[model samples]
Target chain A: MQDTVLIVGAGPAGLSAAAQVAGVGYKAVLVEKEDVLGGAPILSGYARLVPSGEWARDAIGRMVKRVEDDGNVTIHKGARVTQLNGEAGRFTAKLSNGKSVKAGAVVLATGFTHFDSVNKPEWGFGTFPDVVTTTQVEQMVTAGKIACPSDGRTPERVAILLCVGSRDRQIGREWCSKVCCTVSANLAMEIKELSPKTQVFIYYMDIRTFGLYEDRFYWKSQEEFRTKFVKARIAEVTAAPDGRLLLKGEDTLVKRPIVIPFDLVVHAVGMDPNMDNPEIAKVFGVGLEKHGFIERGEHYTNTCGTTRPGIYSCGAAYGPETIDDSISQGMAAGARAIADLHGLTRKAS
Target chain B: MAIHEKSLIEPERLLRHDNLVVDGVDVSGHWNTMITPRTITDYDDDFEAVIQRYPGAENVHRCWQCGSCTNSCTMYAQNVQFNPRYWIYAVRTGLKDEIIKDKDIIWQCVSCNKCTSICPKDVRPEGVMKALAHWLEDEGHMPKSPSRIFDEEFTEQIYARGRIEDSLVLLNFLKKTGQPLVPQWLRVFGVRLMQYLPVGLGMRFARNFFIPPRTRSWGRTGEVLRQYVREQKEATHG
Candidate 1:
């Protein structure tokens, strides 16, 4: 009877874990804090995903449907495991929806929160209506119109500044977000395709379209779509008297300061540790790393194993990760949880 | 692709003390040349538009300052100062003062077209170099160069006669540019060619030099072509 896996957060990681556990004929208890599934893809309304160019709703919707249709998976929407009791083999969890479930393993798939652009006031995110984040640009792309939010006019020139919230020593964020470069490149191509007349410029310190993404996003954007990449880190974004946004920065290649005017400016914001990492650590009786992510049990052998036994975690709960990577990690964590539980049952016999 | 410019410390900015002794040690001559630091505060905003007004420079605004053009440049390999990417950046950003500073070196582009072939943005940097040199001469920033005179002679031969007389074109180009009529290499090549000469081909070349070969059907085509070129120049410049 103690073969159930309690999975929290209905994101890509949690959904993948739920499907993996239920597919093997084991009971899975999936509890989500949100009313609907699919996590940030559906919540943030991402237009098209990086690397695949698939619509977020369509790609993540399939994962959500797979877990929901599984008979062995009992999902509690808008609920959380308020209290988790007992040890690895015999664990009892109390949900926020006034239901208690008995499980052998627990998986925390809590994802990240997008870095708010308002924190960098000089970038003029909140001060100007045309200064927006990459997420807002995605929303604008999904709406099929790229216009200035203030005047609702087609922009002649748009500038995307990379590493806004990530890799900024002033903000105390030392880690790279790992996806903004590719995301901004993909977004540049989409913008050029949608509005061919509009010139898009990406200001970057270093273009880290690492590995396979180099040719896919960076090269394709410049070669095919005519997107401009400038080696510059924009220092400030202010408005001109004519209502155009002026970007101040040195053209690092040419070695001179420039103040260029643009109709719109975008901040390629990064991902931060999930805000509930502190509370989730206390409730689950697990330790957190220095950056406030869930710490692993041991550096030698732990891939998904958390500080506490039988309490595994995956995806952005540990650090900033892509959806594809998080999904794979979820499957790995689920397999580890079930394997460890089966070993405990064998020992008891 | 990184250019370490010696022009950063200009000759005019250097103060040379020929016979100075500092602290009982003679730190004179080469060691005494001290460079005065300078700062720039302004740029000519319309300089990019002025360059684009010239032919082959219309796409200067499309440059993103990637160093690919400079990396693949033939002239850049010979002399690092002849960087198409840096000059294009200066043109786009309306840095006229900086461009004038490189006037002595800007015309050194050999027109190998390697930079154009490899440019991801299709900027056609080879054409841009030609246009920029013409702009420098036209704007009175620099005197007319020999390459511009050579281009004029070459184009003039094409318009006057339908076919090119290579020797005549070379003769006219050297005469107008005030260079020596026969350089050492050409003199050596001419002597070698005369020694191993085929009589029939040599006679044809000599005859062509006297009365250059003309395309038989070129009736009013040359006049019409000249008229069209004049109209284009007027339309663009005016």
Candidate 2:
């Protein structure tokens, strides 16, 4: 049998990649940093996904199951690739678990980290319990309830603030975190559905519910759910006298600087580079782009190629990506790795 | 539907029906004010190119809509409606009607040059403001603003004599725009200046105002420069 294909991170991208590699009559080894499989969807505890509306646990769980059920695939939970050395066709990866794997090609699916709300302290994320992130809100939704953590009281009004920790020149994060607009729109509708009495207001610099998401999330939230969309990025989130969150912002549409109160404030945090990117890049011998995501090579020519040959990267490792896109890219990266592996095996023989 | 740009939802565009009837059910208060849908058919596709024809507006096409110009504008600080960034967007996207809506205030730009200095794309927003103001006047959308008249007379003085006589600039400006020769503020300032001025300085001011000092040997240069300026104006306005 040919050598195994090493897949890193074991997220949506990594899992699908591993499954694809194994399906092609080659061995697949998955090295995950966390103890369990399923990347952000399982790790971050994501709720209903966009477009499909399937629970992340069920959707991404199926991907995990497929990879796990494949006997040709080997999974090392709670482990990392501490070292990687060699050329495109032949490479050796040393895992943190005191094991080594000789592989034909490496697939780095190391995904992104949730932009910590603490970086933008002005939004009152850490200081105030009511001011939570989009991920935290997703977790709350998964738990079948949306209540303020402080008193477990159902909020009368909620404010979903977009572009937090993103598109802010002050903090040096100028790139738009593509998903926040659609995610917040979806979250607004979910919040409205969970609590019929609750009034939801989405504050945004601009709405970028791209492509097919326009009718599904942004417009549907406005039409059916009655989610109030305001074209104003909240400048500050301060605690009111009675413990409600006060949002200070310029309502640019109405052309007035306004201060409004809300029960729960959701900061639609952006996607940052994976925290271990520097170390991963060093180990894998790949380059990162200006925005800190893995650098892609001759985009159209190389489907998922990294700086170094024989290594492919996909999903948030490239940039802010949706779960569906990450999966599709996973299959693509896997197909690429399989093609590379086939060439390497031919050379070895 | 909740548009971020304020101008898109002007009062005239928004229609509120006090008693709206769909099919005899009186669904008035149930539905909110509906924005009168406008399908803009008269898009001047070459609007950005037209704006670039004006002096200092060459970089209008390079705007990435970062809003640094509007954010740093001195006029914008005073009044948010005076948005250089928004006007640039309108010009780039060929929204001439949008630019026309704020005709009166477009000339209020004090030419502070703050927008030009802060513009990352080197859009030269101060120049675009002047260009828009001039475009408005050229298109007969607005009357020649007082500032335009002052700029013309002041520049004409320099072209005519190789130097501007401040009194002549002021006198000619007031005459062209139909204002009194000596306004109240100018009169008050004049009174104070004459009362407090040293004897020799006041005499020099009088001589300069009456004779209007011309450059030595400017005989041919002044005429050539004036002809060049006229040609430039014709080339640009066309």
Candidate 3:
């Protein structure tokens, strides 16, 4: 009998894993909680197909079609694996809306959730109409316009707050949330392109432009777009009478308080593990860290696999990751799961 | 096939059930290092102790080795092991010996207050790290480096003169720490020249260097601190 692999989530990681499993002949059943496949990336509307921004619609369309047409693969939309039982080689899953399935192995590509901007109320996410999140900006860009949420007018000036919840010890998230700097830089460029008249300002503690992501977008914004890169953490956001927002932050480099008024404020919120992963861990009989990511085994041998046998996880399920890293991790996890299933077959034989 | 075997093969029942036992226990002494008590001395002088203290650092006992603080640290991106989280965990569990091992790092903090700012449970990871450095220094575990000489000389100067004279402190630190005085000479000359700069050019910096650190208005902050130190010593050894 052909072994079956159940993949939870339909984001980049999930779709990538499903493609690998189907290629190797194990029946791949991909489940998604959302009505569509792409998850938050689709919601945010960023076309994060690697090698510097290709059309995500085309990429996702191809992957979705391939998974749908594959003889050994099944796609379940608006369905979630509510419960998981048993272990490697023979596992059972309970799906939402009262369906059940059995699988030889499980892959949890349940990705991360964006840290809520409202957690630090000082930034005035919901309190002020102009202060929006990176996700909101992505949606506006996807809709072919960059209009301020409050007035629906082209904002004359925009301020992007980097590390809103990320790298903030007060908010209890200290990690860099790696992708924020790149995403913020990219978004700043996107905003400048979308609305050329609007001056963009990125308020940051420090510009962490690491890897190939270094200096390219940052310099482009500063030199070409004339984006103001402020070395300061925003202290408070207060509303002005004329609907403009006032931002107060200490320019630590200069050691003075900088009060800037902006028409729009975009909070470059950080990423944290998916909200549901903790309950999922309980369902799967696996361990989760205190921060609530599925515990991985020795990172070398089991980079994408969990501490439990036969259960694998990849991408933002561990922490924040870019779309490229997520896809790569999905491929690695798929290969591992395939090897595991084949190993089981040999043992039985 | 038998019904029982069929039930075993059923996908829903086979995977979602967990029957493992996980009873919680105080697993503090599980580490081999905790098996024996390690004896060490506490803070050497009252002057050093005052600088080490931060209000509301007693919650250092609540760290659960979560590694969240370290992983979340912005500083961790630069260096993974320079973790306030682990240091806090060590301090919380009374793992003084382990914390003292990190004496060199305790002083390297940039004091951006980022760790304390982001703590989830208000663990004040930055404050705890400061407390750890203080505890280690109290225990005579401070690294005998240039920073130490700076601290010693800075303290000695304040005691000698009512207020700090930067020239004297720097000279003393260089003399004691064996740092070449040539660098000090260059810095002193540079500072003298800097003092003549235009308004708001180097005024703030010059003011900081020349003016001593402000103390309480009662003129008894130093005296009170000294008395407290003497009492602590008596209570410990009496």
Per-candidate RMSD, Å: 19.2, 22.8, 29.5
Using TM-score as the measure, the top candidate is 1
Q: Rank the candidates by DockQ, best first.
A: 1, 2, 3
- Candidate 2: which stretches are off by over 4 Å? A347-349, B1-238
Local distance difference test values of all predictions, in order: 0.85, 0.85, 0.74
User: Model 2, A1-349: lDDT tens per residue?
Assistant: 2367899989999998998898887889999999999998898888899979999999999999998899999999999999998877678999999999998889999999889999888899999999999999999889989999889999988889999878988887787889999999998888877898887878888889999998788877865675666667777889888998888877674355667778899999999989899999999999999888899977888889999999999998999998889998988998998997787668778
Q: Residue A332 error for model 3, in Å?
A: 0.5
lDDT of 1 by residue, B1-238 (tens): 2223545766677787889999999977766766664433334446877887888787766676778999998878889888888888778656777788898998888888888898877788888898988888898988676787888888888898977899998888888877797688899999999888788897898999999988999999999999999999999998
Higher-scoring candidate on lDDT, 1 or 3: 1
Candidate 3 per-residue lDDT, tens place, A127-151, comes to 9888999888877766778888877
True contacts kept of 1: 0.10
Q: Quote the lDDT for A242 in model 1.
A: 89
- Rank candidates by lDDT, best first: 1, 2, 3
In DockQ terms, which candidate is top? 1
TM-score-better candidate, 1 vs 2: 1
Query: Global lDDT for candidate 2?
Result: 0.85
* Each prediction's DockQ against the real complex: 0.08, 0.01, 0.01
lDDT of 2 by residue, B41-132 (tens): 22244687798899988877666567898888888888989888888867865778879998989899999898888886577999999999
Q: What is the lDDT of residue B129 in candidate 1?
A: 90
Question: Which scores higher on lDDT, 2 or 3?
Answer: 2
Q: What TM-score would each prediction reach against the true structure?
A: 0.74, 0.61, 0.59
